[model samples]
Target: MSDQPPSHGTPYPYAYGPPSYAAPPPFRIPDAFGWSWDMLRVHLKVLLAAMIPTVVVGLVLYAMYFWRLVPIWIDMAEPTTSSTVQLDRFQDLWATVGLLYAAALVVAIPLSLFHGNLVRMCLLIADGGTPSYRMILSTRRAGRVMVTTAVLLVAGVLGTILCLLPGIAFAAFSMFTLPLLLDRDLGTFAAIRGSFALVRAHLGLCLLTFGLLIAVAYAGTMLCFVGIAASMPLGTLILVYAYRSLQVTGRTV
Candidate 1:
């Protein structure tokens, strides 16, 4: 018999099963930082644009806080040690504190949105997608992001107050929550749980990665506090890259 069917309508071949796919490569912590650095170099403009607003907001808030308290501080510093004067200064200090608290409350929503967008931007870069400044300003799931942030803040504060280790663990495990929310469209609590699962699977690696990121951020702050403009984005990109790695390696929830 001929090896192939003679002038058959279909090509002669043995039955073939479904194609096989190669497993994704193992996730490497170093690759995350390396790839993030590459992204930073190539996408500097977009990253910097996304980062500038955050820095500006922080600076403006700090300036406002000090400006409001400067007069009270000066009054307290003056040598007019009268009981009435001291009482007035104390009242002024309390009023200033309340005003700052109100201002922070008002700013918290937008700040949370910005942070979520930063994660979104870094995730996009890590996924080999182009990101823009406009995209940074345009955020989705703003309400969920804000609520999730509030939950984390409260939990982290309570944990820290009770014991240091729980707070540290929370910070490490929850690092990917924002990325999960943006990438997987998960609800707030679901994203938090997913992040916990991911970190749990590779607890040591995740903790080491988180610690390195903190070091990078601290180094940036040490650069006359201006290096944060670059370090923050770089650290975020590294984190997003690691999150992507976990997804590909099937380590993510």
Candidate 2:
């Protein structure tokens, strides 16, 4: 009777808290790959434009290796007239190798600065936003991206020297570092940590994505090496799409 009488004032049992909503499930492998391909198809032009720097740098590096490194190796292999001459030639060979490496870094470091811009463009396209070539070319986070890349390269090389597994693990953990750095404006270490966390949380999915991308790139290579121009950008778009889906679902590392 008292409850009925109090009906106008409030419910018989007052609500204690806000209603809860269930979280969405993690992205399945098929869904992730499908979405990535769809996004790539939609933004094909912009994605291909983004790959220009990568392609150019790759060509330059290849040319340098073929022209400079090959001659050095050939000269080093040939017989020399005397011990002193051999020693001098060996020193010259080392000097040439060092110079070639330095030259590569000089060219590659600047070109790699564009990677952040490319990732940003991919993310923008994934979010249904149309980004212009001029806008995509603006690399505000180039310095940070370059530094992070150098760190990862050193870490990967050191890990590889120690054991191959650690190198693979480092690469897997860093799959999202560039995107995280660009999107979040995070410091290098923070972005790296975030990427590691994301990968650690979804290790199997990350591995699948990574392996599939490598396979795609390899296929591109097999097709007279011209396929890389298309495959590389497509792979990048796929990664951006996967990252977008994870972010949307609030699946942080």
Candidate 3:
């Protein structure tokens, strides 16, 4: 062994936390390069683990709604009813179920966000960047993003109820909200408002980028679920970049 003292140094000199950068790039996420399959696969184990909580939350919400509402009206919903009773049954079927389901979903969105952020955090870590679950949790401004998200969700559901076409369009428009919210220090409302403004500002580009995502999703659905599990991550990563580009610079469609 050499008689030289090994120089002791911090793992990441001039940086904090792990040797990983752990923070987003200062400016913008690069186009077509923000995310990749290789990067995503490195994080799949994390994603799979995160999904357990999400699945559990979903099942809980479903169970809550089913148990709470089904017994209430199912007993009242007799098949052999007179014409007037049939009309009442129809009214209860459509309208009452609608209200109950809406209430159930209101409870579910935050749970879903929690799950999504879990995945997002893992992605950041796996991408060779150091980030924290604490920072991720702190990103939410409570009132801002949550309320905006809830409003938009209601609006989207309403749009879908109006017609399938508008629903598809609305869903497409909503593609970037998650990354935008997470990557920025945006309150819930600001993030949502910014998302809408960005989409409208670059309507064509937003539509096109998200359109490709839709096409991919459609193809994935057609090929059975394997395609979706593999492909969804890539598409989601694309959103991270796309949202960063739209917000960081006033790039037009």
Candidate 4:
């Protein structure tokens, strides 16, 4: 195939077999990050497609969390007839919340990495190639990235406590460590180095991608956090697609 899009303007490239279902095309990551508004307008449909499942899952998880709070609310709403019982309830609530938060890492940390790879896969499919969920699933098969995620998750929290700089910088620049590690089957230092290499020359694009993500995330939160379940996949797919595009083009991604 030619370096650019196919000679004909058909969006997809290969002659492939049936996908999961012949329903509609799955989501695609964009060719790269620095797309023109014109191009984005053209591909907005795929971006939306990439995001659907993410939003549904996020909404369901949120609903479950929200329901968990209902019992606490009911308890408080009941006449506080006794400060003793109220205090006991509050303690129990805190204990449960703490346990849940601690336990969540086992799930959340890995899911975080999966989410990143999923966006990358979307980009791959967008390039008129097959996107393999197995590619992403393979990344999680070993526990290395999972451990890194837990570390990063804590590092991220600690960074927040120390100063916003650490957190912000990690979010933008080092965000790819997990993806690099998983996709390339690299070690921690290697993944870190690879991520740095990937964005070394394109700091501006990386920062811009991060800025866009923050903007979208902010917008989603303002929408009663529906945006989280709503916007994350969409936001993430575009950014990942753009990044991969830049890298594959042998330009400073």
Candidate 5:
């Protein structure tokens, strides 16, 4: 498929055909969820391997924060501490907190890169194409993926701050940015635009799929947060499946 967008009056490569008088097929949420679970079960080992770095990084950060805060809490709790000393310690603690946050964001860059590649791997699996570990970890398009992710994060944050509804709208619209960037090798902005166009073209279907996946993820979070180990990968598979469905039916722009 060409990376270039179709010109005015031209048909999109993945455009759906004209509709018939009959009703369209319904979005089967249960089937999609089941398919996600099946894919996760088949590739459980690979998915866990891919998630190791992220899980380790998170644990390390959490431990560091806990260790660092315990002493501060003890110091604050001491009635004998001088006001000046307490203020000085508090400033130091705040500075340390800022540094930790900066460090986390830096770590997140590579994590996002790996995640984008993992999404592509899932897409390949969904399409019946075998993808190797080396290919999945390859950095061929890491730059584009990282840039697109940063843009999405900023936009999503700004939209959420502006209004709750626009934030949800932006999140729903840009759901396919990573997949499009990986598969089409499009520029960051181009991929973002393509995601919006595609989701807009199939708004209702996209909304239902995205919402269901979000609901599943939320449910996982409620389960002492351990369920995310299963739900997160399942959500990714469902997304890749949905993307493939749209691609196969020429429903994506």
Candidate 6:
């Protein structure tokens, strides 16, 4: 048995070959950030191309969310004269809420699919390969991405309810789940476990990387969220760089 999957007579879209660049020096957060910045600079056009659709879709979803609230707004705008009218309004409100929940579920599917493709792109870039926006169209392994996201969400929420530290731990350990699944085609639980094991083996480094990534993202938020447009992708690239480094220097069972 081999870690590498059987070739399907294709160039193997994900990063799977030898190092394209020289071995990087010891893990440094600044170095990772600098490398990620350089990647963004070199690949800005393709990155923007892939990102534009996601932004457009997200804006559409946001509009749909507000549109769904129109009924509630109208119901509240008119003063009810009778108890029956009030009851009917309440029912409509609840029904509208239900519709919103359903819409969220529907939206999650495509968002998760887009997220997986983005992970694929990041991994490919980290491997020193130039990728196209067309790669974002791939829906392969989207189910794994959705399942892993759902599991992480549930586990993280439960951990948060128990204690804040537990939630942070779950998030930190599971950082590599997406990359593993998208790059290696690992199953949901397998990817989760592999991410956990890999992070645990290099706990200090992984934790520092995760913490700094969060801090950078938070800093972006403080700049009126316009910065998030830059921070979020940069953080992702930093993590992907770490993932690629770990994958090259170590092995996951």
Scanning candidate 1 in windows of ten residues, the lowest lDDT window is 1-10
Question: Top model by lDDT, which number?
Answer: 1
Q: lDDT values of the candidates?
A: 0.78, 0.72, 0.57, 0.58, 0.74, 0.73
- Report lDDT (Cα) of residue 163, candidate 6: 69
Clashes of each: 0, 0, 4, 4, 0, 0
Best by TM-score: 1
Model 4 pairs in collision: 29-122, 29-123, 32-242, 33-242
Q: Write the per-residue lDDT of candidate 4 for residues 1-253, one digit (tens) a residue.
A: 1222211222444468733322222112233333323333454555445445556655666666667767987887788678799999899788767665665655577475556555555445545555543554445435776666677778776786677888777666666675566556778767766777776766776777677777777888787566564456546555555555555544432
lDDT string for model 1 (1-253, tens) is 1111112133334569754455665656777677777778888888787777767876787778888899889889998858998998999899898889767666766688877888888776665577877887885898899988888877776777677888887989899988888889999899999999999988887887898899999998777556877898889887886777666665558
CA lDDT of 154 in candidate 3?
Answer: 81
Model 5 root-mean-square deviation = 7.3
Give the Å error, residue 74, model 2.
7.8
Sorted by TM-score (best first), the order is 1, 2, 5, 6, 4, 3
Candidate 2 lDDT trough over 10 residues, lowest sum: 1-10
Query: What are the TM-scores, per candidate, against the unseen true structure?
Result: 0.76, 0.74, 0.58, 0.59, 0.73, 0.69
Q: Which ten residues in a row are the worst by lDDT in model 3?
A: 1-10
21-93 in candidate 3: lDDT tens per residue? 3332233223333444445565666444444444555556556666756865775655664788777666766
lDDT of 5 by residue, 187-231 (tens): 988988988888888788889988987997898667655566667
Question: Residue 177 lDDT in model 1?
Answer: 89
Candidate 2 lDDT over 1-253, as tens digits, reads 0100001122244377754445554666666556666666766787777777767777776676668767767877888878997888778777877787767655656666776777787777666687678855786877888888788877876787687989988888898998888888999899999999888877787889889878878988776556777786667766776676566455675
lDDT at 193 for candidate 5?
Answer: 92
